[model samples]
Target: MGERPVRRSDELVELLERYAKEDGTRETEIPGLRFIRASRITEPVHSVYEPSLCVVAQGSKEVLLGEERYQYDPASYLTASVYLPITGQIMEASPDAPYLSVQLQLDMNQILEVIQAAEQAGKPKHESGRGLVVSRLGDSLLEAVLRLVRLLDTPEDIPVLAAGFIREIIYRVLQDEQNAAMKQFALLGSRAQRIAKVIERMNREFAQPLKVEELAEEARMSASSLYSYFREVTGMSPIQYQKQLRLQEARRLLLSEGLGAADAAYQVGYESPSHFSREYTRKFGLPPGRDLQRLRETLGR
Candidate 1:
């Protein structure tokens, strides 16, 4: 058989390894970009993935959004236009050839700004779809991504050029064949916009118990319609969304502050410590104390 077509992914992977820092840690200075290098695959961990795009230059990953699973590799890109609770695991990583990737955080204000500009330019109306999507990678998109990542080497130029590069990336995404999904984020009165508002509110007050009626009213949709649309966009119910927000915060408190189980639970809005322990175990596959202990051990290793 003829030799398989050579993939540029390997080249990009090598560049990332030379430039990227360790995985699972956010770089201090960058507000909207993160580079990761992981020695081994990670367990599914919970977090609220905000609007963003993730490109895997080297390895692959699987994300669980509610019951739905999304897998993306070098040949594809993943986008989320609203806040979502997700469990993500690196499916392709190792010590010799670690997983390398960059995450570009999305800014709603910037998205809106682009939307207005596009509308003024008479961009065609876009159809609606799920709030999250994975699209096959394209050469132009990859080139833009590479340029954005490469800018890190010249720190002084970053402040001046980063915003323009980000805009270029977002513009490239808007011009893609599958642009409709991302376009929904820019439409002010669109169903996606309403849902995004609710997502923002949920993130802001995640510890408080949420009321579906209140949320529906805020979204200006009937309760049933809100339920259907929210699930259609986010793949989870309102209550489930709030629960995830709560759990993620509790985990953060436990891991970062070294808070005890009861204190962490109470701080995260759980009324009964026993109930918190049970739910935490169910969600993370271990009770708080043991789960944290295991995390510490893993870090040590």
Candidate 2:
């Protein structure tokens, strides 16, 4: 039994390496699951992380959430229990052993269902914690993940079996020592859950001016309490969080829509082109035009 999980983990790594043949992210036939491959270390990529589980089967990666840096490799897994703006980089890779990983987006409803079914005793009282966490990956969880990935090769089994496997994976995560953080996302009315609602509102209305009182109301907390809890979970104040979302969207506009700096800035709710440029440079380490050019060259676009 001990050897079985190790063998399964090896098999999982081989399958991920084989399927992820290119140097970019790829979506599988299964919903909410994606694969990433990188033949070399990558530059920092800024984006919002949805509720998801990220497991590296080979190599290593790092994610920057607010000012905190989280590094993980094959021995561990990263989880984002809420939507968060983050910077991610592939820290180790090579042509001989490319980085291979899988990201599974979490469905909150499914997570709640798993928790209910388990009906575990003495569930911990919810406490505020960062939504992003790295936890030691255990053999049981790895075995369940291996089974889930194996189904990709046999597409016919996916419809009937994928849900069960995914549920098992979530169950494993919730039962782990890091369950407190995961519970924030699953338990109703937890501070993390309340903040998640506010985050959703921000993402949906990012272009509009932010009002802390409105956000506080949305989260059902007083403004001061909201500020403190928001900072606790996200490592940033409400305004800073909104700025990250805006800047990330502005970058997307520049790259995907081919918008000029000023245009992208205004489109994403920045009123001052120069102000936007300053913040953009500060966040991405390059002025908007230069950053876009570099990204284009790197992507060969």
Candidate 3:
């Protein structure tokens, strides 16, 4: 009798366990792919989820996008087709089993290349959808992911083979049932793509005060249309999105650069320290000073 095939999930768990030794994200030799392992349940982590695909091989995670909550496990994967401010927490983990996952950042140029080469069907016109999505994982997709992970063991083979494997993985994602949304996200002139451009500008200029009319003009849409489409893609108005980005950057400055709360606020374009403190407290459930203290304590810094 033939030997039984190894389950994809099992293979992924083994590969990740062998490679990942720490509790944070580890950059692999393969460009755009990272491995994450955490040994214990974690508090909510606020960060930007870039255009990427995240797959869980063990344990589960919950991600909060605006008012929406998405939970995924070994049987599902999360895809963010645009930059998004999000809160994520590991829902299930422990010392023995831990949480193992892989994050592959998506490249728009590569996605467009695949679409053009395949002559893929165009997406039908529809209302803009949220940029973040969770889809059930199929066996074929899981197999492709496993192959990509396996390439790490042979670093010499990576340069020549990684690109083709990565392309195949993305092709599998494009073939998912949610392909319509993905296609819209990549199409050059779609409203979603237009809104994505506006988001790019916001990220670059997040420290500045927002100008809604100017952003609408940049997107070539009416102010109201920009508002609607922006909210549809990001789950928040442009002002709210900018505020989130500012606050997140302020927190990073405080923690990573050892800046004081008031200085951090000023650095992120907040004019009133009191107003910044209030908003920071409201968003993070702790004042900036206390939050920074707790983070440092937890990180053993």
In candidate 2, position 249 carries an lDDT of 97
Candidate 2, run of 10 with poorest lDDT: 120-129
**Per-residue lDDT tens digits of candidate 1, residues 19-57?**
765666456244688877788888777777889988888
Backbone clash numbers for all candidates listed: 0, 0, 0
- Predictions ranked by lDDT, top down? 3, 2, 1
Ranking by TM-score: 3, 2, 1
Model 2 vs. true fold: TM:
0.96
Pairs with steric clashes in candidate 2? none
Tens-digit per-residue lDDT, 212-301, candidate 2? 998898888899999999998889998999999999999999999989999999988989999999999999899999999989998899
Better of 2 and 3 by lDDT: 3
RMSD of each: 3.0, 1.7, 2.2
